[model samples]
Target: MTRPAHVLYVAWGFPPARGGGVYRALATSAAFADAGARVTVLTAAREAFERYTAVDAALEAHVHPEVSVRRLPFDWPAREPDRARWSAVRRAAPRVWWRVRKELDRVSFPEVGYGPWRRVLEAGARQVHADRAVDLVVATANPYVDLVAADVLHRDHGVPYVVDYRDAWQLDVFTGRRKHRRGSRVDRLEGRLMRDAREVWFVNEPIRAWHAEQHPAAAALMHVVANGYDPQFAPAPRLEAPDPARPLRFGYIGTMSRQVPLEAFRAGWAAAAARSAEVASATAHLWGHSSHYAVEHPGSSSIPVTPGTPGTPSALPTGGSGGGVVVHGPVSKTAVAEVYAQLDVLLLILGTGRYVTSGKVYEYLASALPVVSVHDPGNAATQVLVDYPLWFPARDLSAEAVATALVSAAAAARTADRATRQACADFALASSREAQLGQRVSALLDAAR
Candidate 1:
């Protein structure tokens, strides 16, 4: 028990990918290393980063120094419009799986792009285990296919597996939709893999509750590990201490894809700006990827692209003068707190309701900044931030209500009590991302053995 466990973690988006899960995965693996595990992370390669999402060098540095990572190469450039050179599949991609590809990419998984990565991933898992034997195989999902990779090692080499489900595979946590019908291949596969795993971890309580109801047999294995601020990226001091002078700089960081409801924020902003022109003189800056391939995903907002998508400080909006709205693009994970520091307000904008808990929410709370929520009432982040001093929850999507709420948030920002502020800091301090998972991973490792 005193000696370290050799853990091989299979996560599709680790480090460079700029996918939100990268932070959790990096932190967990790094935490495992800290908790005395000799960790070998079998993650999708740096090439995968340029293909699926933008890269974040700063986030890459956040990976623990002791952790060893193996980069697997993937050819996703075929999905892009112009890069049709190497594979015949790329040239024929248009006709071969045209309809399904569009549909899969539309919904963001299963059909195109990530679907083909299955074999590459399975091979990568085998390569890692073959290179060296492992005691535990942990897989974090969302290319839930990564679980297939872990299953390869488990089924073939008896490397016991744990499935860390940051978000449910088939269940739509936001709307409680099936995301598709039951008994589908993917759903059945997910249920089967989940059933066989040593442990299944989720990021929120409501999500764990829902899974328990669905798979009561596996309920005992399900555990909640809420996303917390990474010690590496956490703000050391209260970000900018309520900067009110030059427009109360409201900010939204992370990928604002189609589901993000940036337009809703815009709708809210339009009304709120007019109502409190004096207060909103500050800009609403967005930092993160606009879409997967530097292309605008169907529902993503077209805004300024600073640093330009992959840690390029993006901000680009086509029309409406964009006077109050700015897209700062993506920021490096290293400078995240510095980014957090400059903003007086944090905007928590997301699409779903069933039980969504964004990784950014933890950092937002940790940033010690005022938060303006544009998510559903049932959203898990709301549960965590209900006690926050300057939280403005837009229970419904009405622009007027959100506008009014913005005014209230502005008022709170101007005059929140010191104790309320301290309470906010205390709450987040207890939930440091690396620290929480360090404890959970210790238990998971013990159980898997």
Candidate 2:
């Protein structure tokens, strides 16, 4: 007659919020629900996603029916584009207004856009706890403000909390540099939070090590929980032998941020096409949003591509050398499998960073397709793919290096047998989302007992 452990999962980005971190949040919550925990999620309102970022309505279906989600109203004045709603000060002396706004926000918490949300989240957490006692609190961060709710509950009710850092609060993952000065509000706040946390989780060992170095006292509590592919969203491995007559399809998924080496990829694709007949006939598909936001504006970093006619590639400029490049825009999470199924090769083009390991890498591995990694060799993702049988990593981001990798990937696509594809898929089985979250969930629940 024992009741299920009540778990409070706080995340800034959830389903329909088309950010890169949304997938991990979705899968983590779902994993908790599947583990028989009474899961409740706190996230921003649907309007926030619809207005500020792009929304994927289809992803809503992925949420487990048993899990309850409560959306809180978020105030993000910085991202507000509607000038009509702005005050005179914001319209006239915008810089001064922003400076004042940031100062006011930091009065409550150290973060700018998210600091003001601390009180709102605390109130929400208190209200949730009042209804039914929360057994454990798990807070995922980017805005890092979500951690405040967990901290509030822990301080007020003696509840244990877990801080799940999707990225660092004080360290810039891309540059491996400290974002805040010593003794600053951010540093003090992060130190206090980590010191009080029951456990702190990071996406990779590098990030964990970095945080451990910063917080030696809490080093023993830190753990690595890598981002793994969700089985429901991953495409089945393409086991069929390649038909030389049909052109191969190379694809890239996830956000195309400003840091992504798109120009290098373009040049490399063209050069690879000129050198290899298989690559010459192949088409490259770019899926997902261009930049972090879906709303297109003038001078945006998004690559311009005409909407393609059915059964034809989009009119994307390839310098008149390579195979056609098509921009399919953002694909729905529900339709991920379908899009990935059509791709013969997965392109892992990432920004240069030793700590950058994208979630899409797991999906690419699961696809069992030949992967062409057009990123820095020093990237953390390279380590993950080093043992991958079908991975073709570029030596560098240069056009020649990328072209070489692309050509090799193309060759693999044409010649790789079903056994080789299966072996690659087998290698990825250990990295499934369920596999990654299962032990963690059990440990947390057991601790709650």
Candidate 3:
């Protein structure tokens, strides 16, 4: 009998770590296993997620039984002592110790929080390779330290590796700015990995194009592997329009990161109410962790904005003016479908950029709800949702433009028929993660041959 191709998958955020990139990481592992590869995943300990980032116990139920996950120690000395089991010194003065510890960690490895794990991960890869011949090593990055392990396995054991860059390491996606100086440690490391990698994968075309332009020699190896929505979270398409009498419910489910322009969204919602009767009664519900640390810790931070920025209306909600926008805290994955079912319009709020296509946008597409895009017109998501029939893009980031879009979207939500609903569902089905990753996995296997 012939042995199956052995794949060593490296990712820092896997199941239980409910971060945005977790879905991509989890799906990649399943795709490799589904393609008949013997897959093994190396990731940070579950405790690390519980102590720092929020955890989604629901995701564990979805992981394939064939895949083996190995967890290594990852102590986040930055976050305050939760129920985590760590040293008293680390628990007491995290702010003080983190600064000192982080500096030393960077000296050994270029990555900040994850740099110290370099030795353990490299050793883990070597150990996995020794147990059985590893035919391929696929590493996903945020820490980018995973590339070090991939490089080590390739150098020591002659295993070909792939770099799955969920996001760019040296390029800021939001601003299209260079994050590292030329010929820096990160620059040298990135160059080495790209040169050595068998393939380089990116989530979107713009990101791939940017990398290709930066490294012309490695451009041939670059491939676009988009992040598609998981079928489990999407509710059945709503064929009926929402009741005209009741207040329209606009929903957004994702992290409320610093990049999110909530002030503009709030301003727009208020403006829509003032301008249109159909929108006046509308309520926007934000359902997700405010920030990664918001759910687990106290004193969660928020971005402060000027009283009235251009395009931003001054009528504040309650604390400043009235009540309509509600911020619901994070919910479990099991409850995600129910949340979508309750909404009439989906608010697609995002940062401004040509390279920012968030994974949530795909899930929003799957919901089959009327979408009000509260973002810069130049965002990459506009490219994805251009053909989506239910989409109502804002003219600009200004409050008045967003308000107009919101009002239009509210009307669309109340008038959408069966045909419109089916079209949205069809759009989602076409970009299903199974279909997206299946093609990539098949291509990867063929390349390995």
Candidate 4:
């Protein structure tokens, strides 16, 4: 009898680390296991999430019982800094010392904060391979250092490795800017990994296209494996009519980082409120982490902001004007459906550019609420939402444009016809992660054969 293919999957932000990438990582691992591959997940210790980011114990339930999970110690001084435990030299010149330490770490291995983990990971991969043959090495990245371990296994043991880039390493997704200088360590290291990888998966075509251009020789190996919504997290498509007495509640549920145009959203929301009474009375409820960095500083509530322009609506508790933008902060994975059920409309806010596509868009699409997109028209997310019925995209980043979109979207939500609702439900059911990942995982496993 033939044994199952042994797969070693490396993802630093695996389960319990309630970041945006966790869902994608979890889904990928589960897919491999469901495909009957003997999968072992190599990830950072769960304790790291407790100290650095919010933890969702609920996500653990989704993992396939047959999958083996091995957690390694991670030293994230940047995330969980301990001044109390600092060395004399570190305390004396903290900034200088930190910079030097970073340089040293990068020199040893090409990743930050995660560079030192290379030796441990390399050792772990070798041991896993020694115990039983590893047919394929799949490495997903944010801490792209995980790729190094895959590369090590491929070079040493001849195991074919797949590199999965949920986000780019050398390119800034928001600005479409190159982050590294020519011939830099990142450029050299990433080039090496791409050239040797059996296949490389990107979350979108634009990103894959960019990488293809960067590494012409590896272009043929590049594939688009999009980040998609888990059907289980989807709230039943909103069928009820919008309440007329209370203002429409437009909600956003996702992490708010520098990439998210919160200020621009605030301006647009205020302008929309002033222009339309329906919008004026509407409340924009912002949920999820204000910023990933906010976890390090627990006392912080909202992102810092400049005062709103005069004549705009009054500032809300969250820094935005119109008293419409309300920040609810982070919620557990299970509470997501409850939050979605309360919303009359969903706001899809994403960073600008071809490289930027927020994972939250899938959830927004699944919710079936009228969506107001506060993002660049050039954004890759536009491709996904363009065909989606009930999607109202902003004309531009200006407050006037966003306001216009929001007002129009609110009107649509108040009177969404049955056809529009059915279309949304159909679209969501078709775009689920299971539908997306099922064939891709099978193809990948077949390739391993």
Candidate 5:
């Protein structure tokens, strides 16, 4: 009898670490385990998630029972807020201390906040391999230090590794610019990693093309594995037509980062309300974290938004003529379906960039609700929604354009029949998380044989 292929999955942000990339990591590991692979995940300790970012304890329950998780201690002195834990140098000459710390971190790896983690990750990967021979290594990156573990295993044991880049290491997706100069340390390191990788995965085609241009030798190995909605977590499409008498609900989910055009959305919402009675009566709901960090600080700008009761509006200022806007703070992953069920339309307000394709796009598509796109037309996300039946894309990021899209979406919400809603849901079926990961898992399993 043949045993299952053993796969080592290395990631820095596993569940309980509630970052945008966590869903992909969770789904990827789960996909492998579901495919009958013996999956072992290497990640940071639970304390690290609690200290650095927000935690979604509910998400841990979704992990496949067959998969095993190994945690490592992570050090992130830069984000430490407790002055009591600070060294004297950090308290006195903080800038100088940080400079020295960054230099020390780069001595092991090129990344600043994550470089020092390389040694620990390597040791952990080695120990895991020592216990049972690893058939393949799949490393997802952002701290990119996780890739070092896969590289270590490949070099030491002749194991093949896959680099799953949730985001680019050299290209800034927000600006579509090179983060590192040509022939710089990051450039050299990334080139080496990609060249040696058996397969390379990216979230979108634009990002994959950018990386391919940078590494022509490994172009054929690169693949675009777009982010998709998880069927287990996403709510079923609301086939019932919205009541004409009641006010419509427009919602936005995911992290509200500094780059998100919140001001534009406010202005647009107000304008839409003024122009259309349907929109004027509609309530806009914003869900998810105010920023990447759970706590607001000097370097971070967590919006001064108050959490509203699940079904009620908050007392906070709505910032525009429309009085129905509510900020509902972060929602747990387990409760996402409930949140979607309450809304009539989705607001896809994203930062401007040609390469930016948010994971929210897939979820919005899955909701089968009228979607108003309040982002740059040039954004890669536009391409994803171009063929979507219910998409109402703004021509530009201007307030007028956003208002126009919002008004159209509102009208759709009121008049859209069940067939139209079902068609929208059907369009999104191809983009489910299981569909996106299945082909890759099958290919990897075949190679393992």
Candidate 6:
């Protein structure tokens, strides 16, 4: 306890970037600060946040000002001007430019758009460590390039590092499929870097098990630290639900990514509404940016949707989603709870099953409201919500199955038992992001020597 381990935290989506990773990273950097460590966060520029994902000024308000945030320029090709200098392929046509860039991006790193930012990140990590010597470097991977940065810092500076795999880097978690080619160059690199990591953190048991099975020895160092709710985003005084005359208001909060089965969501929604006279009495609400809503974009094999404005939902059968599924757009973290107050039920939807334990789940559970699982049963969110007295879990993609679950969850919503409410509250008590990660970093620091 005499000396706290200085963690040079590297994350791409720190606060102000409303990407889900921001919550975990913000909570993490702040969590380290709470543990009495001097935390210097090296991240990409705020402008980058606005471009890659929706900008969350409200999220910026909750960031721990005590933590020193140093953001490097993250200017990428996508955000670049001077197409005049673009290679012939990129300069040819808008369509060709996208393909050319996609190819180049994959050549740079497995992730799109972000793969090329690796050099800046590595330099930032090393530069932060140089100006202020750090005992340990804890890098959270999403672009997964942070691992490369941490590896560089450790290799060059001997700063012991921890690689927090909020989600697995090699596994196609959604499909329960693996991406790594055995003994492939990427595989060897991942294995080598993780080999010397001081610690590794995962968000849930399934992901932990997958990583453990893949890197059995690393399991000793691996820890499963679930994504906890951010206290700042926790629901406040319950807002009255829309009038009973208004349709049942179910809501989803987070990115409208293509990976998400938006069509499936539409199907389930239509099925539920058509079957239940109650649905005629209710509407669905979606909060967040749908730029990546797979269905909204073409070329994606996911269900296709005609894309247009941001506020409207995809076109649905009989009743268009724009009318039935009202998108409120991205809310400030401060206003999140107010939005939750408007919902009779929360929709838990994500790109990947099980491996996905949405940071919002904690906040959702904390709302003490009924949640409808629009996700896989294997998800960590389910693990957290399963114990909650009021959750109705949807186990499959079947519209009938989802409709039934929604009905059940809706019924539970009307007369949510007091015990259920309290249990929801108690369930989230320790799940506060700051509290959870504070405990985690404290222990990691205690054993660091």
Number of the top lDDT candidate:
5
lDDT per residue as tens, model 1, 1-449: 45567888888788777767778888888878887778998877786677556677666666788999888776564455445453566356756656655565435336445666677788887887777677898898876767877788878987778899887876787677777566776766677787888888999998888778777778888888877888767765363346445457777888777677776777888798888974457667777766655445553564333332234322222222365776665667777777776667788988767587788888887867678998777778878888876678986777887787777777777677677777778777767886568667878677655
Model 6's TM-score against the true structure: 0.86
lDDT of 6 by residue, 1-449 (tens): 35656778888878787667777888888887877778898888987766555576767777777788889887567655445756676666778788778778767566778788787888888788878778888888887877777888788978788888777878877778888876876677777777798878888888888878887767788887788887776775232333555556788877766777666677887788787777656677667766632123334334444332343333212223543665445556667776676677888876656677777878887787788888777766777777776688777867877888888877776666667677777776777776667666877777654
What is the alpha-carbon lDDT of model 5 when measured against the actual structure? 0.87
Per-prediction TM-score = 0.87, 0.95, 0.91, 0.93, 0.96, 0.86
| Superior candidate under TM-score, 1 versus 5 | 5
Candidate 3, which segments miss by more than 4 Å at Cα? 80-99, 294-322
What residue pairs are clashing in model 3?
Answer: 311-398, 311-399, 316-321, 318-322
lDDT values for all models: 0.73, 0.84, 0.81, 0.81, 0.87, 0.73
Write the residue-wise lDDT of candidate 5 on 1-449 in tens digits. 78899999999999989978999999999999999999999999999989988699989999889999999999888878678999998999999999999998899999989899989999999999999999999999998999999999999988999999998998988898898999999998899999999899999999999999999999999998988998888878887877776778888887778889887888888788899998887788787776776475553423333346542223222332226777765788777888888788999989999999998899888889999998889999998999999999989877789999999998888888889999999999998999888998899988996
Clash number by candidate, in order: 26, 0, 4, 0, 0, 8
Per-residue alpha-carbon lDDT of model 2 for 328-380, expressed as tens digits? Answer: 55677778888777778899989888888988898888988999998888888
> Which is the better candidate, 1 or 4, if ranked by lDDT?
4
Ranking by TM-score: 5, 2, 4, 3, 1, 6
User: Candidate 4: where is the Cα deviation over 4 Å?
Assistant: 298-322
210: Cα error in model 4, Å: 0.7
> Candidate 6's C-alpha lDDT?
0.73
Ranked by TM-score, the better of candidates 4 and 6 is: 4
